[model samples]
Every structure is written in C-alpha cells, then in structure tokens.
Target: MRFSTLKSVYQCKCPRCHQGDMFLRGKLLNPAQFSVMNKNCSNCGQSFEPEPGYYFGAMFISYGINTALFIAAWVALSVIYPDYSLKLLLALLGLTVLIFLPFIYRVSRSIWISIFVRYKDEDLPSSA
Candidate 1:
C-alpha cells in the first residue's frame, strides 16, 4: 500500500503526486518567502489553492501545533529541572516558538492541505 499521503505531509510535497514541492525553494531563515507556495504542482498540475481564503483553516492547525509544542516543552522542562521558575520556563517556550515559527507555518499548511487532498495512483506515472 502506498503511504504517499503521509510521506507528502512530512516532506511538504504535493498531495496529488507527492513529487512536486509544496513551497518554493529558499533559505529557511528568509522570512520574505518562507511560506510562499507554488500555484500548482509542477509534476501533476494540481492547483495548490482550491479557493480564496483556503489557507485560513491552516491557522487553526498552526495554533494546535504551537499549543502542543508549548505543553510538551513545559512538561519536559519541568521534569528535567524541577526547580525552574515559571518565568524562565515561559521565556524559553517563547524563544523556542519564535525560532520555529516559520517551520511551523509551512508544516501546518502542508498538513491542512493533506487533510483535504489525497494522492492518486494515476498521477504517479504522469508525475514521473
């Protein structure tokens, strides 16, 4: 069985063909185009934007991801350093979230799109 859908999400590939990259190639630290995406899948001609305001849903996904990351960080820090102050823990969490914001933004959009799109085996041959 093809796990291309799962692979696509993690790799940030096109959902239809799992070949074309979802976002444009650029330095991860380049905030200018970090979340910039191709209008269509280069391999399958699948449109990235199905409708206007489509990516608005991705904000929810991003929020959930950040929340989970925060909780995990807090729990791990508490366990590793039992005497750490709340202020310090919050500061660390803030820094961590800020540093990973761009990554999380791209990932959340990839995940959101994958939820509504599925890989088609027929698109595979044409993609190649």
Candidate 2:
C-alpha cells in the first residue's frame, strides 16, 4: 500500500506484515532448487506468492539495488579500509555478492512484485 510497506517486503521479511520471515528458507531462495512459498501466510493467512512470475519484476529491482549497493560498498571500503588493497576489496565483495547472487535475484524480483501487489490488492479468492 505504501513505499515503506513495499520495502519491508523487499527486505525479504513477510510481505503481509514485514514482521515475519518472507521466506521459509531462512531468508534465501534457490533458483535451481526452487523453494516454494506457501500460497498464503501461516500467521495472517494473506497471500504471499500471488501468481506465476509475480516475482519476476523484483529481478529488475534487485539488479538495480545490488548494483548500487556494490558500487557504494566499493566506494566506502576504498575510503574506510585504507590498508586493504583495492583489488583485494573488489575480490572480496565480488565473491560475497556472487555467493548470494541467487538470493539477491529472487529477492529483488519478489520485492518488485510485492509493490504492485499492494496496489492491485488481488488477494481475494479466485472465482474460477
């Protein structure tokens, strides 16, 4: 319904309330493994995964966020960690991001979709 509400979903916390785990996988998603979300929240009974590809948009959102964060982290580390070599810092950030790449991708998509979901309010039970 609001940007703040949507961001909470992007945080990979509960989409319904932002207070619970959005993911049952301990805040991660496996593209190859395909972790499925319950159609509705266990706590609130509100729909979480609304439809197929509902999370695809979050991919674009995630890419933008991750890229920006990486760049910022690079700048911050370069300035703050004066002793560390630039190459080393880059390498470490690269490896860390790479390790969590799948999760980032999934989360970005999930959050992006969640924004629209708030506006659409398509949680009503399907008539079909």
Candidate 3:
C-alpha cells in the first residue's frame, strides 16, 4: 500500500515503507511512553535511528510547532477576551504546550526522520 508523505508523517509511520509504525503502539493512553520509538521499521527494516543524536534537529521542529501553537492561542484568546490579563495569556500558553507536547514530540521526530529516509515502493517481507 502506497502512502503519501503527509499521511506517513502525520500517522507516524515509517518513512521507508510507510507501513510499520515508527513508535510503539498504545502511546496515546500512556503519556510517558509517547516519546518511545522503534529502533527500525518492521516492514522495510529501515533504521529509525540512523545514528546517535540524529534527532537533535527535531528539537527545532518541536520549537517551531510550539511557537505556532502559542501564537494561535494568543490570537484566539485576544479574540475571545479582549481584556485578557497577562496571567491568563501565560496560563493558556502553558496549557496549550502541555496538551500538545506528546504530539509535537512524535511529529517532530517523524518529520526529522522523513527528511532523510526516502519511501520505497517495494516492501521487505516481515520476519514475523
């Protein structure tokens, strides 16, 4: 099955095969496990962590996502409450970051890996 880049990235699928999950399943139910990732793609045998410290750049991606979310939350708050206080704005931003932290962490890593791993149409037979 062929998968679009955006779909693979959003779904946190392997960039090479787009079939195997880059992260362990059931992460949504457990926030602590949300950042855990598989070492390699089960479908294509592609290494998720090509090298040590490979995901360092993903920090920037996460930063950008957080910044955008913060800006959007600020704008929404301004529209929703023109007289919003500084404390209220800070609270909203903090909550927004907390709520989206897991998602942002996963997507940032997914995007970082996708930048280097090209999709392959041919799937490697699973050993399972």
lDDT by residue (tens digit), candidate 1, 1-128: 36767778877889877889889866557888887888999988989999999999999999999999999999999899989997999898999898989899988899889888887877545657
**Cα distance off (Å), candidate 1, residue 107:** 1.3
Please report how far candidate 1 places residue 57 from its true position, in Å.
Answer: 1.0
Residue-level lDDT of model 3, residues 25-123, one tens digit each, is 878547779988999888778899989999999999999999999999999999999999999999999999888988899999999999998887765
> Which lDDT tens digits does candidate 2 get at residues 1-128?
57767566656555655554555565354555434555665655656667776776666787787887788778887798868886888797897687778677657756665655443234345922
Winner by TM-score: 3
Model 2: runs farther than 4 Å from truth? 1-7, 10-13, 17-20, 25-36, 81-89, 99-107, 119-128
Which model, 1 or 3, shows the larger lDDT? 3
Error of 3 at 90 (Å): 0.5
lDDT, model 3, position 116: 91
What TM value does model 3 have? Answer: 0.91
**Backbone collisions counted per model:** 0, 3, 0
At residue 2, what lDDT does model 3 achieve?
A: 39
